[model samples]
Every structure is written in structure tokens, then in C-alpha cells.
Target chain A: MRAYGFRVPGGFHATHTYEAVEAAERIGYPVVMKIVSPDVVHKSDLGGVRLNISTAQGVRDAFDLMMLRINQRLPDARIEGIYVEKMVSKGLEIIIGMSRDPQFGPMLMFGLGGVFVEVMKDVTFYIAPITHDEAMQMLMSTRSYKMLVGARGQQGVDLKAIATGLQRISQLSTDFPQIAELDINPFIVGEFGTDPVAADVRMALQSPED
Target chain B: MLEPLLYPKTIAVVGASKKPGKVGHEILANLIKGGFTGKIIPVNPTADQVLDLPCYKSPVDCGESIDLSLIVVPNRAVVEAVKSSIKAGAGAIVVITAGFKEIGEEGAALEREVAEICVSHGVRLLGPNCLGLINTENRMNASFGGDIPMAGGVSVISQSGALCTAILDTAAGLNLGLAKLFSIGNKADVSEVDLLRVLGRDEQTKVIVGYLEDITSGDDFIKAATEASTIKPVIILKSGTTVAGLKAASSHTGVLAGADTAYGAAFMRSGVIRAENYEDLFDFATAFAIQPLPKGDRVLIITNAGGPGTMAADAVENAGMRVMSLDRNVATALKSKLPAAASVGNPIDVLGDADPDRYLAALEAAQEDDSVDAVIVILTPQAMTRPVETARAIVVGCQKGDKTVLASFMGGRGVLPGRDALAAAGLPQYYSPERAVAALKAMHDYAAWKRRPPRIVARFRVNTRRVERIITRCLRANRRQLG
Candidate 1:
């Protein structure tokens, strides 16, 4: 999560369409608008996301539509605010997470992200906190490592950047023991020379118990 | 300590019975038959004597300290029996009754009571449903199981008494020796961690083989095993070692990060050989029992058949061992000595019809190859092949060694005699080339582990507070991320 020094899309939210347009202009064009709330876990599934808005008018209009649709979809749903962020167009999606296993202590997981992740789940696990070399091994051991390394004419991503991101997550969990379940989905790993960024992150805190 | 638990000076069979088929009677009989010179006392309320040993109404009435007590009373009477054993100042107790834990909530509560009693009394309890423990040093057959096991360096600690007996029978057949065998059922007080740490210090134990179903918490055990592997090999065969990489879940690493993944990491970090299956467990133990660790990673596969040799080559490579190319001189010598049909490659097949003498010539070539760290000799049942003679020749060639050698006598009826020869020579042998390669791989892995430097974990403090503040700002601004 951005709160944990993990890279995330940059943009700002505003109260009105005018403020939304102004915020989009300040952040640059091609922003994504989504309904942000404490209640909603899956915003896209609720038709609460508007993507790739290139113009200020596009950001303003999309923000209004997103809020209206979310309100109409769930009449009882409490609206927290609207989230606007710069859209990431070029990158392969990957997922990284950590879950504290009662028996095994802290465990970290890595795998390919996107829709096909469920159809063809390719993932691996390691006990936290993993070193840079081990993080690299976890990345390379996955089925998508070849794609990350640029196979079949597809462009390669900066593996070190992603490995470093994983290591940072490792450090984050180590630093914050209260985190029980963490999911950083669709960590957009850009083509060579570009830093990989975590697009979405959700963490569930561990409830205190014996 | 383990002295009273393992080499007890006086043992009491709490539920001693006159009946032949009863567990108490059988344990009493096994002790006498095992030639245990230590005093064996029987405890029973009604019986005058059991197995000709004078009986006491209870351990409390024994009027002397009991080093170890084997409690085989009924489920209802176990707690009372254990308390009396504790009252008699028993240092260790092996409860042989089974109603505890395995029978569910009430039984688990009962087991907990037993554990609490043992801890409060400062006593070590082996099991509530165990076959019992054996001390090869004292020739003590404390279990109701069969004949006294042979005394040797390997120590077996198993959670399952049935599996322990099976392994004992197998070890007996293979002429393997054991320093101790513990059927640590339900581990009420002493778990694998306690035994591993204790046995790591026991001089009689050179290798430890553990069969466990679960490992709940083992940071101390990992540290102990890591220290133990510094001097001896610890081979473990864990039941239900699930591959975390196969579990389907919402997270990408769900499968790879399952519960069992921790065990794998623990073993790797501690430098223990975790056998993939039962056969691997046996093979690895047998290799460690018979052979020395390989000097290096280079392995040479010499066989009579090309196919099996290549299969072994692939296996060796898969096991992360290299089949190094022989030196020019060694290859030339092999080329000239081997028949025209032979190949002088890494496998260095000596032709199918090659006899024991041909095997010797190749074995000699392997020994001469400076790059060859270990040799796996494969023999097929060819018409002209003399399997036993080849085995003897291979053993002879391996005798002049700094390098270790293993034999693979492939086939059933025809290779049995040769396999026996290899076994009789105290040389490790397998029925298949891959099995042989696996044994060699174990040797290589042990060597590699021994060579690994002391582990040091470098921790980096990444400042998440700055990231947290930025994220909080974004959340208030309704922005979650940016490219």
C-alpha cells in the first residue's frame, strides 16, 4: 500500500466536478475515477470504476457518473468519497501479499495478476521476511517469470524493481505485526527502466486474541 | 535428563499382568528377553507376581525410586497410575494407554491432566498411546514390540508407534543398527524438539531419523537440528507435507505459501534432508548409515546399459548434481579398455554384456578422474554378465577410495544375488538407477549443507510511516494510487 512505501497511482480526490477537473489538471491527464468507501471491498464489481479519462472534462464527467452509479446501485450504501488517480496503461499485472499463519508465523506469497490469475493460478510462497535473493527466486520460480524476463518477443520488465518492491512489502509486514492479511493486487510492472507500482492494496488488521 | 528416560537404572511396569497376550505382560517379557540387566519391577494390585518378577500393589508401595515407569493401565485408571508413579519418584514415564487425545475432547482433557501432572512432578512423559522407548546402549526393550533391535548409531524418533515398528523390522532386515527408537505417541510432555535437542548431544547417535505428522512450533528444533547437522545428518520423513504452491486461493502465492511451506523453509534453513516419501526416507538413511558424505558435487555414472545410465544422469542433474566430464586420460583409458560398442561419455556405458572385470576397469577410470567426486555403478542383467562378481569387483574398486561409490543392481531375479553381494559388502545398493542416483544425491546434498556458511539474516528497516502519511492524505483526497 502507498502507506507502506509501496508505489501506487498518483492523483487526488475532490468534492465537486470543478475541483475534480482542477485536480486532474494538476496531476496530469488520463486519470481513473473510482468510488472510495470503507464498506466496498470490490469497487469494480459494483460498476464503480471509470478508467482512462484523458481530458479534464472526462475526469469531471466520469467522477459524477461514478458517484451517481454507486449511489443508484446501493441505495443504502454509505458514500465515503470519490478516488481519482493517474491511469497506468503500460505494464504487466502481478499480485503480492502476506498472511500470518498461526502455525507457521508470517508467510509471503507472489503470483501473476489480472483475470487469468484465477484460470491459470501461478504462485509461490516463502516465509517472511525474505531476502533480496530469495525474493528474486520467488519471482523467478513462478510460471510468469519467463514473461517478466521478456520471452516470445514481449518486452521485459525491471525484475529488480519488482523484487525490491517485494522486499519492501516483506519489510512492511515485519515492521507492522498487526497486519493479518494483505493483498496488493495488479502491481503494474512496467517495461524495462520503469519502476513497478502497486495499484491497489487492502490490509486486514489482526484482531487481538489469546 | 535423557539418562533416566533412556538408560533408566530401574523400570516399573505399572499394569503388569500374568496374561500372555496383555500389553503389560508382553512388555515385561520383552525386557527379560532383551537381556536388560537393570532391575525390572512389576506393579499390580491383585497379582502376586508377573513374569516371575515380584509385584507391588502400586508404585507408591514399591518403597524405592523408579527411574522409568511403563504405564499400561486402562483409560480410567491412567491418571491415578501416573500420580503413583510420580509419587514413587519416577524420573520418566511412558504411558501406553490410548484413550487420550485420539478419542476426542474428554480424552484430550485427560491427556492434558497427564501432561500437567508430569510437569508439576518434574518428570518427562514419552507418550499416552506409545509402543514405548528403547535404549540400545542398555539393551532395554521397553516396548511390547518384537525382538531386541540391533545396537547401532542411527536413532529413530517417530510419532507413530506402528511406523516405528515397521521401520525397526525394515532396519533389522537391512542389517541397520539403531542407538535408540522412541514411539513418541501424542507427545504429552516431550515432543520431537526435545528429543532432537537431547539426542544431538548423545554420543551414541550419529544420525537421527524422524517420522513426524505435524510440527506446530519448531524454531528451537530448527536451531537444534541445524547444530546437530553440523556433526550428524538428520533425515526426516514427514507425513502430509502439502505443497503450498498447489493450493488455489484468492492470493497469488496462496498455494506456495501454505502451512507446509514453513516446514520446507525450516528444513532448508536448518540444513536437514527432508525425504519426499517413505522410500526416500529409507534410502537416505541407508546411505548416511553406510557411506560418507561426498567430497564435492561432481558425480560419475558408470553403467552397463545406456538407457538407465542416461536416466540416472538426468536424475543426478535434476538432483542438482553435475555429471562431470572425465579427464582425457581417464576417457582414453576407458575408451581403449571398453568394448567397441561402449560409449565414453559422462555416463560412460561399458556395454550391456560387460562383465565384473569391465566394471572394475570403469570404476578404476572413475577413481582416476580428478573431477569425479562420487561414482554410481549400474549393472544390468545381460546374458554374459556375472552380477555377483561385478558387485564384488565394484566393491573392490571402491575400497581404494577417498571418493564414495554406490551400486545399482537393476532387475529382479537375476540381480538379487548381486544386490545381496553389495549389501553383504556393506555397500549401499538400489534396484533402480534413479534410486542409486537419489542416494548419491543425498550424499551430495549433505556435503553441500555441511559446506554452507553460518546463516546471517540482514534486516532492513523500510520507513513505512512516510508512505503511510502519503496514503492517508490520498485517502482523505479520495486518491488511492498513481503511475
Candidate 2:
């Protein structure tokens, strides 16, 4: 099953191994290491995530600690190592999700991201394969969107780009039954005019047929 | 129209058994124990005697024509039992069996088959997967399920079996009686709409209450409720109003609709009263069942405490009813009755130290004013404020006046005497200002709706037709595939 994300202009993927850590050190500083285990969808829950690694030893130490933590917490999960991506700076956080309801068919949910998803519970749902109209409605329903629209002198996040991204996620969930859940948290909205980038992504796929 | 089914003169347990713990035997025991005035027949194949009544082999074998049949048997045998009951000319059948639509596709097909059987035979089926109905007024225990209900004015119809029992138990604790109770689980033939339509016309049914997960026939529910609201009040406690709540409801009942905003609009247009919580629903129903509708939306606030009066004012305003400002004459009259230090406003805070006679005097003055449509008297505990005597005085003053009187006693333990005294006098009383204000608002709204014509204009004209066509085609396709 293919997992296609919205196109980020300068985005590139880097596979993390013992050698990749050394390469990352040679290339740059301030990288994020995320556990790439398909079984562990929420890597941060098991402490398999390390952010803002600035040095060679920082990379090596974080890798060791993350590996040990993942093995200790989820002993049965297969370790596919990790993905080291450039540490993107702060932005307006949001979450988009989809699930097939038995009665209402496919449903798309969009809301404020991070811990605020539970705390604020500012979310809206629509039957999936959502039109652009519905996507815009979901964004407008949430109070966090106030900040996205430049509340309190903050630069307004690009709403058109966010709406397009949401539409892609909805289509993806409708297209693949195997894709149970997917999340891209803190997809940093770079500047006033710059497009948002998916900084950290975690996905869960259905087990292969017996 | 079907009085015998509701208040049966003769009820026959088709699958009755001599075994002590069986459903049929338990139902018979409960019916006999509840002192049902109707004649009971036990139909068993082998046993000559069960529950001290002659047990026949079948409904045909039992000589008398039965009004209702309580069918408690396995899934395969239900069809045969229903067929026999139909041949014996039974009017209604309450099927207390599971393994139907609620399970999955195949079970849904079986449920349709049972419904078809009922339709073809002209026998109204209460449920294929239900606890069945109870007419407490007539001591008619038709349900095979456990709860022996008490007689009261509130009639509740629940979509869930467990919730029905829970509401019954809670109502029992609250000293509320149910006029009739129905657990319409998996409503194959008889639906909530059907029951609502029937009970709406029932004379003994003062308050028609419901606990619903979904409205299967949205148009039918709107139509039935619109007509029902013309005569009686319909209070509903619907669960699936939020996305998370919709998820829980689906897992509980497997039915989901669009957003709750649409449902709210539909409910408003149909003139149905929606309650926020379980306690609110029961409290509103109790008040509606007992109290007369308010003459107008103008409300007079009477309180011994200032904070509760403010709270009552807020609640009253929130419910879209006005808190009446005291007339100059009424204020002058109240000033003469109250002490000089007392605040003689609309809420008429007569001071906590005021006696029962002072409360009576204030209420009398407020009630005499033509501008005051209703009066809500609030009492708080104080050293000199005789709670019981003050309640009696207010009740007496209410009896003498033309205005509707409502009371709020705002404390935990100190409010019992006031509540009991009001209840004994058949006057509406609430524990909190919010509840008292809500009840008064509902009374006001009901009176207003009664004056106006029913306002449902049939949205979903094309969508409903399309859905009906789709359902018809699907049913026909499924029948062909099965055959």
C-alpha cells in the first residue's frame, strides 16, 4: 500500500541507520529522529522520538536511547530503525483524520492538533470524499482557526494550502481500506507566504493477509 | 384504537411452562403477582397445569380468543408460534426473542421475515427483540422481561432494553410512576413512531417520554410528533447529538445520521421538547404531567434569597421567557406586607427572617396583579424561615389566586419539607432555580404551541422519495438473492 503525502517543495526523505547518523552529522545539525516501526503508530507514546539533536554524539546517544526505549516498551514490535528529518521550527499545529463509519459511511475529522485535540475538543466531522466546501467548513468551525487567520497580530496561516492538504487526506483514507490511521503533527507553517510542511508523520497499515 | 392490546382483558402466554425460572412462567408469576384483572391462559405442549392454570398445547387448543400473545421462544420456533397465534385470532404479538437484525445482515433478513409474517397476518408485532410493553394502569404485564412496573402518569418508550430498566429503576427511586412502558428493541414491525402515534391519543397518558438512538423514519416521526404535540406534550432524550456521542450510539444501536444541528432544527419545527440530560427530561415530564400550562410567558419571581433569584432570572431569560417586572400596585401592596428593610422587587426578597404569613402576604399581592401571569416562589433555609409552614402558606395563597404558582427550594436537606408539601398539594416544585425556571418555560412553551397550528412543512421531499425507492429496491434484491 502506497502512502502519498501532499507535495512539500523542498522535502526529502532520509533513512536512518548507524551510518545515516554519521551522514546526518556530516550534512547538518538540528535533526529529528522518529521511529519508523509500522506497528508503533504513536512513537512518542513509547519515547521512540528525539528532537533537536545538534551534534554527532547527540545523534548517536538519542539513537541508542530511542532503540532501547522502543524495545523495552513494545517488545513484540519489529524495529525498522528510524527516519531522520530536518527539525522544522514552530508553526500553527492541526490534525486531520478519517474513519469509515458503519452507518454514515466514511467520515473526515479536522481539528486543532497536539494535546489540545483532547483538551479543547474543537473538531468537526463530515462524510468522507469531502468536497472543498466541507473542508473549508471543518477549518472554520474550530476556534484555533482564529489564530490561523492571524488572530492577535500573528501572521495568518495559508488556509488554501491547509484545505488542499485535508482534501488529500480524506481521498487517501477513502482510497485505502488498509490505512487504519495516519497523523502529521506540528506540520510547521513556515512564514506568512510559505506553504506548511509535514514535519513528523506516523502511519498504521493493516496486517498482511495470512 | 387497539385498547385490548394495551389494556388486555385476556392475555395468553403461548409458550408458558411449569418450570420455575422460565420466561413464560416468570411473566405469568409477575402478572398474577401484580394482580392483573385480566384472565391468564398458559399454553404448553406437555404440562396440564402451569402457574395453577390449565396449560394447552397451542393457541388453537386454548378455547378463548386471545387479545395478546407473549411469544418467548427460540428464533426458528417464533415463526411457527406467530403463525399459530394468528390462526387463533390473536390481536397483538410481543416477540421476546433475540438473534434478529441487531446482530448483522442475516439476522436483519430474519427480522424482515418476522415483520412480513406480522404484516400478512394483520397482527401488530411489538418487537422481535424487545422487552415488550407494560400497561401499568390496567396491571397488564405483557413483557417477558423482569421489571414489574408501578402505575403513574409518565409513559416511556425506550429503544434500548437496559436503558428502559434503568429509567424504570430510577423513576421508582424518585417515586414516579409509569403509565405505560415499552422497550421497542430492534423495532422490526412496531416502531417508536407507531407507539408515539398510539400513546399520543391515549387519555391516561399525560406525558409521553422517549429515549431514542435514531429516528428510522424521520418524516413519520415528525408527522406523528407534530400531531401529538397538538394534544399532549412529547419529551424526548436523544443521545447522538455529538460526533463522539454518535459513535457511542452506533456501537450501542448501529444507527447514525448527519449532524445534530439538523436534528435540532427538525425537532423544533415538529414542536417536540428536547431535554438536556436524564434528570431534566424526567423533571420536565413530571412537571408537565402534573401542572397546568401557564397562562402566558410573563413570570413573577418570588424568592427569600437574592442569589437564587438572580439565578432564576438568568434561567428564565435563557429559556426565552420573560421575568415580569412587578406592577406599581403589586409592589406597593408587597411593600405594606414586607418589612421596610426588605427588597420589594419582582423577585420580592422578603428577607430570610420573614415568617410564613409574610410569604403568604407577598404571594397574595403578586397573584392579585393582572400583569403577573405566573409566580415562582423560592425558599432558602434560615433560622426564622419555617420551611414547611412557608410551603403550606404559599400553597394556600396559590389556591386563592388566579396565577400559576411554582416554587424552588434551594438547598440539599432543608428543601424536603417544602418539596413534599408542594407535591402533596399537586403543585409543581423544583430543587434548583434552573429546574423550576425550565419547568415554567416548558409550560409556557406548551401553552403557546397549543394556541398555534402545527408547523412541520415536510423538508426532504425529494430525498425521502429517493431513500424510499432505494430501500424498496434493496429489499426486493435481497429477497431475490435469498430465494
The candidate that achieves the highest lDDT relative to the unseen native structure: 1
Each candidate's chain B TM-score?
Answer: 0.91, 0.85
Task: List model 2 lDDT by residue over B138-193, tens digit each.
Answer: 78777655566667788998888778777878776556778988888888878888
Tens digits of per-residue lDDT, candidate 1, B1-483, equal: 677888888999999989999998899999999999798999999998887778999997877888999999998899999999988889999999899999999999999999999998889999989999888889999998788898888899999999988989988877778999999999888888888888888899988999998764666767777888888899998777543433434333443365477677677667789898888878888888878788988888888888888888899898778887789888987888878888888888888789888889888888877898988888889898998899899888987766788888888999888888887777888878899888788778778778865444446555677755654554566543221
Q: What share of the true interface contacts does each candidate keep?
A: 0.22, 0.00
lDDT of each: 0.81, 0.72
Question: Which candidate number has the best TM-score?
Answer: 1
lDDT of 1 by residue, A63-120 (tens): 8788887788887776767777888878898888786665555677777886546667
lDDT for residue B241 in candidate 1, whole number 0-100? 54
Model 2 alpha-carbon miss at residue A69, Å = 45
Deviation of model 1 at B473, angstroms: 14
